[model samples]
Target chain A: MVEVGAHATAEPLVGASDWDGGALPYRVGHKKLGMWLFIMSDSLTFGALLIAYSYARISSVAWPRPFPFFPSIVFSSVMTLCLLSSSLTMVMAVSAAKKRDKKRARKWIFATMFFGAAFVILHMIEWGHLIGDGLMAFELPEEWLKIWPGASPLFGATFFGITGLHMFHVFSGLCYLGIIALFIKRFDDEDVEISGLYWHFVDLVWMFVFPLIYLLSIKPS
Target chain B: MEHQSKETKFFNMTLLLLAGGAVLVAAWDVAVSRFRGGTDDLFFVLVALLVALLFATPPILFGIRTGWFHEKFVIDDEPPATEAAAEAHAEAHGVEGESHGVSNRLFILVWIALLGLTGLEVLLGYVQLRNDLMLTILMGASIIKAALIMAYFMHLRFERMSLVLTVVPAIVVCLCLMLILFPDSFRLFHLR
Candidate 1:
């Protein structure tokens, strides 16, 4: 009891001063950390799908030639371009938000969502054409009889599995972007930046997927 | 904080250029395929890499030339006291202080190297290089690009080392899982 009152008074001052001066923008919060953790888990999910695809590819006799079975490169290329452009727009939206230009931020975010929607629509069209040609996950191809004539079901299974999963992600990401854009009008700068992180991450994942699924497997028909 | 608006123009210009380049590349790819044989997977990969490089290059270069690369988002240590109080109330834990002196020239150089390696990948495809060698080269380019984006654009290089330490281990573990699981699947198919 000799000096306890004095020490208690001193402690509050130190704590208050520390609280007043030290804070950062783009700081990690519970929500941000949770989102990052979710992204990490999602990365693992994609990793598993990619591993499965690789295993099926390595073990299959007479792997299906992706060039012929898939739609023309031109169509997929356009879709890829759309997605990439969306990434750029997303960065711009983030930059705008950081400047506290909510109006511009909303515009750029809408642009990003638009591009994302275009990508999903194009993918849907491609899937429709492919399904019409007797291609689906786990479905054995009739063309295998005419082409390789000795191909295994693993070829089609892995192809559709990996690409279809990626497509599902693309669709979900579009929806996410759409919702984020809608909220842009009300969100503070920090919140907008947080949403931008997720949007950019989605774009980044697609950047890897475009090459792996669509580009890496293409050989001469 | 004050520098944000000044940099916005540069960022917007870069975005426009990237969008334009993407459209051009898509059109060119389509046009080239009509006259020659259709684009293959390898070719498409090269094109995509090229587009990424093209999109990433201008901001890095312009920032370097204009000396804006050294600018940081957090311009001042003492923000409005009220905002600071509110931030503290929220208990947002982020890196304090501004990031400065990020080397834009170095980043651009890295982009160039990435693009050059992509070109080499395309050349290798035409020169009939072995598949393994070609893949190795292409993947190497991809790694370099990823490193540049993470270290520079994402500012991981300047941030807390702990963040990098945490994220990298997860990525490596994911890669290992891929390596292990893929071969097993291949063996089951009897292709391996």
Candidate 2:
């Protein structure tokens, strides 16, 4: 039996030698492992918000899905496409790093950064439209209150909370990628891959969000 | 004891075989649905073929190369092995093989697949399908997309099995939590 303390001493753990890192069993660097672990917990946070939002959706008979069929869906689809393209570029960046082509890697990194910022801008515009329709994070708009007095206020709260958190992720991911770009020469291929992992994760979460929030709620024009 | 290691190996291999079968069925199911529109006859055929292949693969490989299924070599401290021997042992088992390190080609393929799937998903949203069927398509497609991003872009494909275990368990737990609360979601709620 290999206890935690045995790992530090001469005592042998049967499987420990198979993996890398003297004290740790990590095959990847500790930093990369830490990023993955962070992503796992962050996903749960989004999951909880989505679950609560679903609860709100199922509980009410008439949730106000105020998105215009053509305009809203088109904007969102474009945003989704932008984010997805960014993921491709992120992959390109990592691939370039693997080949030790720093110039091409920097190009891909900048391209990814552009798309990330583009998604944030698009999202903020969508938020503007929603707010124009009286979608406040905390308070129900007076116009909406007049139409449905008994409506649950939880709808807007969850919508903004979930999507807002995801937008925050995009923002932070851009910053993280930018920092990686600044010190691209300092880090190994794994660091670039780790940052790419975070970028794809943000993109992945939107894969679920885009369908559930937009496609499912599309009302026939 | 050597006996215990063998038992452990068998147990782990069995678990792996089962997992491999599950991935096959899932991918096959998705393919059948997306390609064939999920006809029941095709499903049965796919299932039968997949099961046969799953069962036959391990035994065939084992017969061809005994000790191929053995766990990666590790140096226990009872009698220390030389570094050269340890490297040779690790090399022979093929356990340290990195999947993505093969080339950038795999990641490119995965990227194109993701874009194609996203396009398919968007196109299906406009099609007049049953709500349940549409939901199934969306969910299945989303799962594949997520898996690809994790395995390739995230480089989980190249990471050791322990890191895979670390991230996957959390996702499974979250999914189970969602399932537990799923029943409540179906119930009608009244606004106060």
Candidate 3:
């Protein structure tokens, strides 16, 4: 039985040790894998924030649904479209890089950055509308309580906290793509793919943020 | 060259079959709602179908990139059997395999699907379901979209299965652990 156990363990030990000596045990590039690890940790960070926001929301007597359909919801939906388009453009850029079409890849990368910037600008405009309505980080607008009595002050806090973090990620993704696009000639295809991973992840997070934050809170007509 | 063992092949095929079924169901749902002629029914159907598609498309695309569906189209011109040899071959060649590399068309479809899903989410918002139900549906749709982006656009599907196993489970386990705190919120709600 001891010999049997030793034989069973020996196979996996050999397999496990393959990654120890500079070999790509996962058959993935070190940089790409490293980025993936970063993304995983970042996902947890966002996940925790989202969970905390949800907790505050459910526990509160009332959460403000300040976004009306006309400007807020429509604007955010357009923003979602913009981010999705950027992800498509990012894919184009990655595929172009893989094909060694540097010029075309650079063009696509710029296109992605353009869309990402558009999303940020649109988001800023949305924030402008909210702040103009007196929605501060810690204070819900006085009018909001008229619509939703007992509205939680935490609404503004969580909304800004979550969406602000997402917007920062979008802004950072734009800058990251800009740097990659500028240095397209120097960076290899994997770098482009890695950047694309980050870009897509930004879009991925919006998938949750848009619905939970915007759609869920659409003011009843 | 690495060969897919019979069990792995079977598992992949099973995943493909389920994805195909999901697509068919989504199409059917849309058609049924169209025939019903209620605008609200249409919105409900579209939202429901989007939910199904969110779960469906990734597996099919994963299969395509892994060359499970179109294996016959793969040009397996062999030179040697080492991993380095494969890497060098891929370097010399543009892509590892033409059929195995996910097509640009597939990504566009995914993009459109995402947009359609978002549109449906908005439409569902207007439908005025119960608050709990609406939140549940929205959360479900968002998760599906995230999964689609991660699987296709991020190329997690093309990566080694072990990487997917590692990254996905870690996130899932962490999320599950966090779920234990949910009851605390309810207690707070009652206290208020």
Candidate 4:
């Protein structure tokens, strides 16, 4: 391995954080840097999944509409509302941490946890309803199978794959937030901030997911 | 222990998580198929649920003992030197020492806007406009909402340019990936 002491001083690359004993750019905390990078890559993951899902929709002749008209949109809208509300609570948690008000931060984190968990539960219920409608990730319902006998299996695969992956994120985010809640007294604003970043990203991804998955697919009555 | 932003290190969970997720999806597919296919075996569903429970445990354990992300990234928990670094960071962002620097009322307002946008989108979904136009409108509304959350809720506005630059490539790469979908659209139109 080349020793860094060889040059003792060379121009530091861009985006190098001072925390890593380097220089220039990335002056933020490790959590912030890590969280930011994670969000960036995570966003790309969702982007790729969404693009693939749309591609499948386009490539297929006729896709199944198992989500059931506008009611599914309404349910998902409420789910979106829960997540948006959780974001506010998450900000409140960070803001409270900034004030050194651990109690308020704890309260807000608890509230955020409640809201995030609520979204997941609502989401699971929505998924169950869709499943009850005879949708499976790898196979179409017997009804759909009869009509579009040659429809691409990708429709179901991408639907479940993309949405399932997002649901996993939501679940992991909730667990992360819950863990943060358990130790709110020892945490700081930056901790709350990073947690908020992850939570908001989940919300942000859902913002697009809601429109693309539910709204765009609404088959008019 | 200041870390460089240019460093190519990561706490990579992508492959592991993807593998786990794909397994869960397979389990889900199996469970659904068995249920629908008349097997009545709930083993796959149980496995899927077990995976979720297993994933939930790590973060809780991470909380108990500060994990790699916290051990490396959190600055304030360090010595006075890092505390000074934190202060310098706050000053650089013009957010030094004002607890809850952003307006709570404004945040609530943004939340309201998000809620209202959700309502509007849901309503618009009911309108049977031309397909492309409807998708465009819905997409536009969602993008606006995402921006609101990112700028205000996630505090990206207060972050530095370096952090902002990180996201630029993600978006650009996302747009580039859309090319993969282009060739198939013709088949979509003609094949049906």
TM-score of predicted chain A against the true chain A, for each candidate: 0.80, 0.84, 0.90, 0.84
- Separate DockQ for every predicted complex: 0.09, 0.21, 0.26, 0.23
Predict model 3's lDDT versus the native: 0.77
Give the candidate number with the greatest lDDT: 3
**What is the Å distance of residue A176 in model 1 from its true position?**
2.2
Q: How well is each residue in B1-192 modelled by candidate 1, as lDDT tens digits?
A: 233344456665776677567667766766677535322423453555455554555455445434455564333444536542344322223323221322234434444454454444434434555655656665665566556545543435543333454565567555654563343543465443
Give lDDT: candidate 2, residue B13.
73
**TM per candidate:** 0.62, 0.71, 0.74, 0.69
Report chain B TM per candidate.
0.44, 0.51, 0.50, 0.47
Model 1, A73-118: lDDT tens per residue?
Answer: 5556667567656766766676677677778888988898888788
Q: What tens digits encode model 4's per-residue C-alpha lDDT throughout B1-192? A: 222222322221433474478467757677568676322234345445445544434333333233445665674554335443344344444434446345577677788888898899888877768877988798889889988888778876565444554665456545554544455564557765
Q: Per-residue lDDT tens digits of candidate 4, residues A111-191?
A: 988988888888788888778867777778787767666676676788778778988998999889888888876777778
Question: What's the CA error at residue A53 for candidate 1, in Å?
Answer: 0.2
- Candidate 1, which CAPRI tier? incorrect
Cα lDDT, model 3, residue A55: 88
lDDT of 2 by residue, A1-221 (tens): 11222112232334543332344564456788888888888888778777778777767655654555566777888888898889989988988887888888889999999999999998899888878877777666776666666666776887788888899999999999999998888987878888998999999999888877777656544
What lDDT is reached at residue A214 by model 3? 88
